[model samples]
Target chain A: MEITPAHYTVLSAALFSIGVIGVLVRRNVIIIFMAIELMLNAVNINLVAHARYLENLAGQVFVVFVIAVAAAEAAVGLGILLAFFRNKETVNIDEMNIMRW
Target chain B: MAEAIAFYTLAVLILGLGVAVITTPKTVHSVVFLVLNFLCVAVLYVVLRAEFLAVIQVLVYAGGIVVLYLFVVMLVNLKRAPEAHEDPRRLARLGLALSGAVLLELAGIVVYSYGRVTPASAPAAAGPLTGAGNTEELGWLLYTDYLIPFEVASVLLLVAMVGAIVLARRES
Candidate 1:
C-alpha cells in the first residue's frame, strides 16, 4: 500500500472529472469559475507529482507558471463576471445564450 | 503505509470537495468548498515533495484566487444561486447521460494507457534540488528556453489587471 505517482494521477484524474462535471452540470457562472480552477489545480498536482517521481524540477517550474496564469485568469474572469452580473442582474450561465444553439 | 493513508484521505477530500463545489445550491458555499479542495491539493503537493509548488498553490489559489471569487460573489449579490433550477427541457437527462459516457470513456483511456505503460518499480530519492540541481536550474531554464513565455505571462497579468479595472469600473 504505497502511495505512488500513479496514485496521484488517479486522484488528479478523479478531481479533474469532478471539475468537468461542474462545468457541465452547474450553470452558475461563479460555480463554473470555481470548477475551472479545480481543473487547473488538478493539472498542477499531476505536474508536481511527476516532477517529484522522476526527479525533474522542470515540471514544478511549470506549476509555478500555471499558478501565475491562474491568478491572472481569475482576476480578469471575475471582473468580467462582475460586469456581466451588473448588466444582466443575474449570473445564470444558461441565460447567457448569446451564441448558443 | 502512512503515505498510502494520506493519499487516500487527500484523494477523497479533493474529490468530495470538488463535487460539492459544483453541486452546492449557494455560490458562496461553493466557492468556499472550492478553496478547501485547493488546500487539499496543496497538501498533496507536499506529499509529492514539491514544497515550492505547495506554497504557491496555497498562496495563489486558496488565498488570492479564492478571495477574488468571494469578492465577485458579493459584488454580484446573487440572492438566489444562479442555475439553481435545471431547465425543464427534454434534453437535460440526455445531457447527463452524455457527460457520464464521456467520463467513462476518459477513465477507460486512463486504464488502458496505464496498463500499457509499466511504472518504474522504485521511488528514487534523487531530490530535484541539490548542488547539481536546484531552483537555479529552474531559473536557468526559464531564462533560456522559456524566457519569452515568462515575460508574456507578466504582460498578460498586467493586461488582465487593466482589463478588470475597465470592465468593473463604476458607472460614470
Candidate 2:
C-alpha cells in the first residue's frame, strides 16, 4: 500500500500520546523534560509530513524554528533542574511544591 | 511497498523508543533512549525528503541537545531514587485519565478532519519548491521569507543561553 499522510498522522498521534503519558506519570523532572521533547518531535514529524504532502516548504521551515525553540527550552529547563537539584538534592517533581497552594 | 515498510518500521522504532524514554527507571537510561528516539525521527525525516531538517535533527537534537541532557543528568547526581516520596493528595490516576482524554480528543480531530477532506482529494497547495537542493531551498527561504523569525530565534537562543548560565551558576 502507498503510504499516505494519514499513516504519518496516526504515528505522530501515538508518539505524542506516549509523550503525554510520560509527562503525566513520570516523577523524575529530567524524564519529564525528555517527554516534553518527545512531544515536540511528534509535532515536528506531523508538520514535515504535511509539508511533504502539500509540496510546501513552510512546514519544514516551521520545523526548524521549532527545533531552535526546543533547544532553548531544554537549556533553560535543565538549568532550572540543576538549580533545584542543588538546593534540594533531588530530581523528583513531587517535591517541587514550594509554591503549591 | 518499500515506502510502507520503511514507514512502519520507523514508526514502530520511534514509538518504542519514546515509551522507553518515559518508562525507564534510571534517568541516565531514559536519556539514552531519548537519543535513540531522536535518531529514529531524523531517519523518518530523511524518508520524508526533508534532508536538511534531518541533519538539523541529528545535529541539534542528537548532538547538541542530547549532550546538554547528559551533562545535566550527570550533574544532578541521582544517588537516591527520585520517586521515593509520594504526595498524599497527588492525583496520579486523575492525571492519567486526563492525558487519555487528550489522546482521545486528538484522535477524534484527526478522524473528523480526514473524513471531511481526504489527503488524496486535496489540491496540491503550490508548485514544488524550486531550488538547487533541499538545503539550498530551505536556506533561501530561511534567509528571505523567514529572515525575521530566523533572527528572532537567534535572539531567543542568546537570551536562553544567558539565562541558563545565570540559573545554573553557583551562588558563592
Candidate 3:
C-alpha cells in the first residue's frame, strides 16, 4: 500500500481553508491567532509532503523557515494584543478601530 | 489497508479538532482544542515519515508555543468573554454557513481532483536510515544550508520577546 503525496497536499488545502474560514468568521482574537497558526501548519504540511514525494529536502527546509517565521509572528502579534488589551480592556478583533480611517 | 485506516482516522481527528478549536467560545478552551489539533497533526507527520518534524511539532507547538498562549490567556483576565456586544444569531448563522460552505467546497475539490488518482500508500522504506531521520542532520542542514535564515529567526525571536514584555507590562 502506498500513500502518494497528493493525499497530503489535498489535506493541507483542506486544513488551510478551514483556517481561512476561522479567520473570516471568528471574532475572538485568540481564536483567530490560533487560526493563523493552523494556516501556517497547513502550509508546512504541504511543504513536507512535497519534500517527501519529490525526494528532495528543500521543502522540509522551507518548513523549518516557516516555523521560525511563525514563532516571530506569534510573539509580536501576541505582544501587540497584550498592549492593546491594556488600553482597550478587550481582545475582540472588531474593536481594533484605532487604525480605521 | 492499514495506511488507509490510519489516514482516514488522522484526517478525521485533525479536521475535527481544528473545527473544535475555532468554534470553542472561551479562548482557553479554544487553546486547549488547538493543542489537540496540533497533536493530531504531529501524528500525521509520523505517518508521513517525517519523524523529526513530528517530534518538533510536539515540542515547539504543543510544548513551547502553546504554553506561551496559555500564559497570555491566563495573564489577561478575559472573563468578560469575547464579542459581548455582537448579535449572537447573526454571528452563529454566519459561522455555520461559512464553515459549511467551505467544507463542501473542499470535499468537492478533493473528489473532483481524484479523476484518475486513487489513494495509494506505499510501504514505508526501511527508513531514511541514511541520516534523514536523525536530528543531527536537521541541525546540520539548518546551520549550513539555512544558517542565514536561522540566525534571522533567532534575532526575530529576541526582538519579539523584548517587545512582548514591554507591551504586556503593567501600566502601574
Candidate 4:
C-alpha cells in the first residue's frame, strides 16, 4: 500500500500529542523547551507532507521560516533560562513564581 | 514497498524518541533522545523528497540547536532534580486531561479534513525544478517570491542574538 497524506497527518498528530503531554507533565523548564521543539517538528512534518501532496513549494518555504523562528526562540529562551538558573539555582517550573501575584 | 518500510521505521523511531525525551528523568538523557528524534525527523524529510529540508533539518536542528541545549544543560548543574519540587496544588491529572482534549480536537480536525476535502490530482507535468534540482528551486523561490520574509528572518535572527547576549550576560 502506498503511503498517503493521511498517514503523515496521523503521525504528526501523535507526535504533537506526545509533545503536549511532555510540556504539561514535565516540571523542568528545559524538558518543556525540548517538548516544544518536538511539537515544531511534528508541524514541519505536516507542512512537508502537504507540500508534496499539493505539488507546491509554499509549505516547504514556510517550514524554512518556521525553522528560523525556532532557532531564534531557542536562543532567547535558553538565555532566559540561564539567567533564571543563575538567580534561582533551579530549573523547576513550579518554583518560578516571581511574577505570580 | 521500500518507501513504506522506511517511512514506518522512521515514524516509529521518531515517536519513540519523542516519548523517551519527555519521560527520561535526567535532563541530559532527554537532550540525547531529542537529538535522535531530530535525526529521525530529518530522515523522514528525505523520505518525503525534501532533500534540502532534510539537510537543513540535520544541520540546524541536530547540529546547532541540540548543541545549544547541551550547553545549557551542562551550564545549569542542578543540585536537585527539578521534579522534586512539584507543588501540591498543581493538578497534574487536570493538565493531562486538558492536553488529551486538545489532542482529540486536533485528531478530529485531521479526520474531517481528510474525509471532506477531495485530494488534489497529482501534477502530471514536471514543475520548473525538474532540471534545476531541489536546492536550486528552493533558492530561486526564496530569493524571488519570498525575498521580503527572508530578509525579515535575518533581522529577527540578529535581534534574537542581541537579546540572548544581553539576557545571558552577568550584570556588572
Candidate 5:
C-alpha cells in the first residue's frame, strides 16, 4: 500500500494526542516539558509531510523556524525549572503553586 | 512497500516512546526515552524528504535539548519522591478526561476536513528552487525570502541565552 499524506496526518495526530495526555496527566514538570517537545515534533512531521505533498519549500522553512523556537523555549524553560527546583526542592506541578491564589 | 513499512515502524516507535517519556517512574529514563523519540522523528523527516530538518532535529533536539534535560535532572537531585505529596484537590482524572475530549475533537476535525478536499494529484510544479538540492533550496529561501525572520530567530536565541543565564544563576 502507498503511504498518503493522510496517513502521516493520522500519525501526527496520534503522537500529538500522546503529548497532550502526557502534559495533562503527568505531574512532573520536567516530563511536561518533554511532552511539549513531543507535541512540537508531531507538528513538525505534519509540516514536512504537507510540504512534500505540496512541493512547497515554505513549509520546510517554517519547520526550521519551529526548531529554532523550540530550542530557545527548551533552554529558557529548563532554566526556569532549575530555579524553581532550587527553591521548592520538588519537580511536581502540585507543589509549583507559588502564584496560584 | 518499503516506505510504508518504515513509516509504520517509525510511527509506532515514536508513539510508544512518547508514552514512555511520560509514564516512566525515573526522570533520567524519561529523558532517555525522549531522546529516542526525537531520533525516530528525525528519521521520519528523512522519509518526508526534509533532509535539512532531519539534521536539525537530530543535532538540536536529540543532541542538545535532551542533554540539557539530563543535566537538569541530575542537578535537581530529588532527596524525596517529588510526587509523594498529592494535593487533595488535584483532579488527575479530570485532566485525563479533558485530554480525551481534545483527542476526539482533533480526530473529528481531521476526518471532516480531509474528506472534503482532494489532494493535488501531482506534486505542484517544482518550486522556485527547481534545480537546487534540498539544503541549497532551504538556504536560498532563508537568505532571500526569509532573511528577516531568520535574523529575528537568531536574535531570539541570543536573548534566550542571556535570559537563561540570568534565571539559572544563584543569587548572592
Candidate 6:
C-alpha cells in the first residue's frame, strides 16, 4: 500500500485525539503539558504532509514557527509548574484552586 | 513498500509512547516516554521530507523541553502520586465524554474536507526551489518572506528564558 496524504492526515488525527484525551484525563499538570506538546506534534505532522503533497514550502515554514512557539510555551509553562509546586507542594490540578471563589 | 512500513512503524511508536506519557504512574517515567514520543515524531518529520524540521524537533523538543520536564519532576519530589486524589464528582467521566465529542467532531471535519476537496497539482511558481534542497528552501523562505516572524520568534524565546528564570528563582 502507498502512503498517501490521507494516511498522514488520519495518523495526525489519531495522535491529536490521544493528546486531547491526555489533556482531559490526566491529573498531573506536567503530564497534561506533555499531552499539549503531543498535540502540537500532530499539527506539525499534518502541516509537513500537506506541504509535501501540495509541493509548497509554506507548510514547512509554519511548522518552524510552531516549534519556536512550542519551545517558548514549554519553558514558561514548566517555570510556572515549578513555582506552583514550590507553593502547593503538589502537582495535582484539583489542588490548584487558590483563587477559587 | 519500505516507506509504508517505516511510516506505520513510526506512527504506532509515536502514538503508543504518547499514551504512555499521559497514563504512566510516575511523572519521571512519563517524561522518558515523552522523549521517545518526540524522537519518533522527529523521525516522522524526516519521513515527510522535512529534514530541517526533524532536526529542530529533536534538538528543541527531545533535547531541550524533555530536560526541563525532567528537572521539574526531580525538583518537585512528589510524596504521593498526583492521581491519588480523584475529584469524586464524576468529572473524569465528564471529561471523557467531552473529549469524545471533540474527537468525533474533528473526525467529521477531516472526512468532510477530504471528500470535498481534490488535491491540486503543484503550482508552477515553486519550481525554482525543487532543486534547492529542504534546508536551503526552508532557510530562503525563513529569511525572506518570513523575516519579521523569524525575528519575533527570537524575541519570544528571549522573553521566555527571562520569564522562566524569574519564575523559578527563590524568593529573597
Per-residue C-alpha lDDT of model 3 across residues A1-101, encoded as one tens digit per residue: 54566677678878887898888787788889899999999889888776765556667777777777787788788888888888888888777778973
Please give, for residues A47-93, the per-residue lDDT of candidate 5 as tens digits.
Answer: 99988987888999999999999999999999999999889899999
> Which docking band does candidate 6 fall into?
medium
DockQ of each: 0.66, 0.79, 0.50, 0.77, 0.76, 0.71
Which candidate tops lDDT? Answer: 4
TM-score: model 2, chain A? 0.98
Tens digit of per-residue lDDT, candidate 2, span B27-63: 8899999999999999999988899999999999999
**Which pairs of residues have clashing backbones in candidate 3?**
A1-B121, A1-B122, A2-B120, A2-B121, A2-B122, A3-B120, A3-B121, A3-B122
Cα-lDDT of candidate 1? 0.79
Estimate every model's Cα lDDT from 0 to 1. Answer: 0.79, 0.90, 0.79, 0.91, 0.90, 0.87
Task: State how far residue B145 of model 6 sits from its true place (Å).
Answer: 0.2
> In order, what fnat does every candidate score?
0.69, 0.85, 0.45, 0.76, 0.78, 0.78
Residue A65's lDDT within candidate 3 is 74
Per-residue alpha-carbon lDDT of model 3 for B48-165, expressed as tens digits?
Answer: 6677888888988998889989988987887577777564344656775787787678767766776566445443455353455646666777889888888887888788788877
RMSD of 4: 1.5
Where does model 3 exceed 4 Å of error?
B87-132
DockQ order of candidates, top first: 2, 4, 5, 6, 1, 3
Screening candidate 2 with a backbone cut-off below 3 angstroms (N, C-alpha, C), the clashing residue pairs are none
Model 6 segments beyond 4 Å from truth? B119-129
What are the chain B TM-scores of all models? 0.85, 0.93, 0.74, 0.93, 0.93, 0.90
Summarize candidate 4's per-residue lDDT along B1-172 as a digit string, tens digits. 7878998999999999999999999999999999999999989988777899999999999999999999999999888878888788888888889889888988898898888766565433465435577788888889999999999999999999999999999998
Off by over 4 Å in 4: B119-129
Model 2 lDDT per residue over A1-101, tens place: 77878788988898899999988988889899999999999999999999888888999999999999999999999999899998989988999989886
True contacts kept of 3: 0.45
